[model samples]
Target: MIEAQGLTKRYGRKAAVSGLDFRVEPGRVTGFLGPNGAGKSTTMRMILGLDLPTSGTVTVNGRRYQGTVWPLHQIGALLDARAVHPGRSAYNHLHSLAAANGIPRSRVEAVLDQVGLTPVARKRAGGFSLGMAQRLGIAGALLGDPGILLFDEPVNGLDPDGILWIRTLMRSLAAEGRTVLVSSHLMSEMALTADHLLVIGQGRLLADTPLNELIARDAANRVEVRAVDHHRLADDLRTLGGDITLKPDGTLLVTGLDSASVGELAAARGHVLHQLRDVTSSLEDAYFRLTENSVVYRTPVPA
Candidate 1:
């Protein structure tokens, strides 16, 4: 439903986004991830026609956003929750946005209820909290009932319950065959919500694959073995064609072989094994490890 080819964005001499190439297919939720200042937000803004790319082109549903006759109905985006006028009531805010695109007033109310902002529909947005403003922004995006949805950190300031709600909502939207692209810096949250991920670093594409595949590709398939004869077991496993690293907590970290093979070797050596299990790497750990060297800024540690 969305395609970008050689998309590049530059400001003065610095390229905020450089030659990004990807496609967001319909019927699946594509999670966009990157470190701070990695051009994720800039890229999203370009897709929404908020920023013009320096080179290449991006299209939603096979047409540029600006070229679409009814652009709001083709793609809905929530780039910033604070885009609404704080002085206007929630209902009036949506009504004004809806009228801009010639959308009916009923859509405003429908979307308000859809995003669970009906209770405060008449309240001034200036008095609403960040989470409430996020909901209002979401309501505005859904006002047109657009087929393609782009959410940039929809859960940024939300509570745990709001986070869960957005996750479920994204999945359901994709299940209904609508194109959904949600971006976040939280790898843990993305792991739970996204079926596929488009990871970027240094304004470049790093990896784009299924969530499970991304994890499995970088997963440290090591096993933690604790046995009565820890030293002896480590030595024996080293001879049996596996690398062993000793931990300070009286355990051996075994790699290059599965736990079952490690177990058999321990049994052959007459060693009593107390614990034998695979230690798979978490998505968050893998993400940090991959992006550590690409981070734009780092805080200094004082001695």
Candidate 2:
């Protein structure tokens, strides 16, 4: 398990992360989410001991990452897929990491094959495509078979097949009781992959909860209704404090009201209901609601 207590980091006059306290327990995938410039990269760097925190602490297991001997055997990370040497072959790169971490040379071949890079193991990393490079980087992370893994945008530049492969891989790893922390911007994928989430904005911990809870908390309660007398039903709902929106297809989108209440109201008003059901919000919807104010860079909507 990974834990942080009052973790903070600053750069000159700017604070990157402030008083972050959370635990990434084993046996599940924890998604690290935040908007751009929200200090996600900075926090991850501090967790890996790549940067010193201005105050407090973050530890892998019970110890600091920098103080651990044979660090790869305890925690493996893929923060940057392009951090490899351009001139070295994929096989050589893994071999070098294995040698330094006291991992067996045989393990290098195993991970290379595991990542499906055995066919192009001899190719220079500089020439590998983005997807291939991501695979190679994953191979290095698995070289030690650590119990804890951190993947930052592992699906970036991957094809659909590669994306599915990593998703399955992370889930299986968690099934084996290993700790997995994934950071990505793809909410659709995160909805399917993560069991829990750690959301931050402006370097402050905004949410640390289960996936379902986060969705339920931020997603607005909305109900979709289709009826013969859409106009009458909408007007009636509005009078009862329901926020209503009339769609182009003549459907009534009702908010601040539940499906049963809307149905009962329509029935009492003698309106013929065609369809009445709750509109489920996607992860994207909840994420937008949660991070609306946290967004640093906004694209102005066209008038």
The alpha-carbon deviation from the true structure for residue 12 of candidate 1, after best TM-score superposition, in angstroms, is 3.8
- Model 2 error, position 23 (Å): 1.3
Worst 10 residues of 2 by lDDT: 213-222
Give TM-scores for every candidate, taking all chains together and pairing residue i with residue i. Answer: 0.87, 0.91
lDDT (Cα, tens digit) per residue for candidate 1, span 1-303: 989999999999988888999999888999998898889999998898889999999998787887566777878889899988889999999998888888999898899888888899999999989999999989887878889999999998899989998999899999999999999988889989888888888888888788888787665557899999898888889888888899999889887878889988877779998899988887887788678877887779898
**Against the unseen true structure, what C-alpha lDDT does each candidate score?**
0.88, 0.92
Best-fitting candidate, scored by lDDT: 2
Q: Supply every candidate's count of residue pairs whose N, Cα or C atoms clash at under 3 angstroms.
A: 0, 0
**Residue 189, candidate 1: alpha-carbon lDDT:** 91
- Misplaced by over 4 Å in model 2 are 216-220, 227-239, 269-274
